[model samples]
Target: MGSTADNVTKGSCICGALRYEYTGDPAMTALCHCLSCRKIGAGSTTFTLAIPSPNFHFTSPSSSSSSSPGSTHKNFTVTHESGIRLKTHFCGECGTFVAKEGAGENEFPGLMIVNAGTVDGEGVFEKLAPPQAELWVKHRVGWEGERHGLMQCAGFPDGL
Candidate 1:
């Protein structure tokens, strides 16, 4: 059994093409109602697990750097298929969406945001802390009711 405080957790995408070992505490986890999220997630809202950069880990060993003690693992790679440089990685054979990185690299400092749905098992969502806030609510399709007691926002927050 994995505890909520577990340092590591495994996740993959739909086709299992990608695999990831996420570490450290997630900065935030939220259900996004943006159009982009809905299109990618295929759901009314997209659940994301945001974490600091240092906590993000990739299982694939990159040719750029050899593995060593205390060194980071390169389990996945960011693809530029859509010309937007979406940092999505997955296993080659299974095509599973593992984890995403580099969301708040420049402004927020060390931060990597990932989708919570990528985590394996049914209880992963139960283990995660409730979302602190909602983003892109202006594009929300319909009322999703109350979640975690946090009111949904119409758009990006003033600061965030």
Candidate 2:
């Protein structure tokens, strides 16, 4: 159903201040319309890939970056309206959100919810598996038509 761990996928933030590399196939992919995601992305919906924590790691800053040791990114934690806690990591320099880490109580604990748009390389976005679901469909804006045929849930799927 997906690529193997050997197929490395690399990405970074808008300014390349935060870089990352992940191995193996993503656990799942989805288009989220939740308020938390919308605010973070400043868009109607956010495309995300859920990768196991062990498979995802932040790469070293490029030589041109002024980022010093241990200053790769910044973290912002928020408690979702649904009662789940999330800590979002953003590029320290450009403020581009890189990924999100959920508290243990989250539906996908230990999974890194990566911002799919940050992924680099030609046709890379198309290479990852297609989104399997759409979360928080109730919050989807009217202008954005439905993603027909995809599993649409009002909130995070139970036990996902």
The top-ranked prediction according to TM-score is 2
lDDT by residue for model 1 over 23-60, one digit each (tens)? 76676777778665565556787777777767666554
Candidate 1: list runs displaced more than 4 Å: 1-6, 15-17, 61-86, 90-95, 102-109, 146-148, 158-160
TM-score, each model?
0.67, 0.86
Tens digits of per-residue lDDT, candidate 2, 71-154, equal 667777888879888888788878899888786565467799999988886676667788899999999999998889889999
lDDT of each: 0.57, 0.82
In the order shown, the candidates' Cα RMSDs to the true structure are: 6.1, 3.9
Error of 1 at 107 (Å): 6.2
| Clashing residue pairs for model 2 | 5-24
TM for candidate 2 is 0.86
Q: What is the lDDT of residue 157 in candidate 1?
A: 44
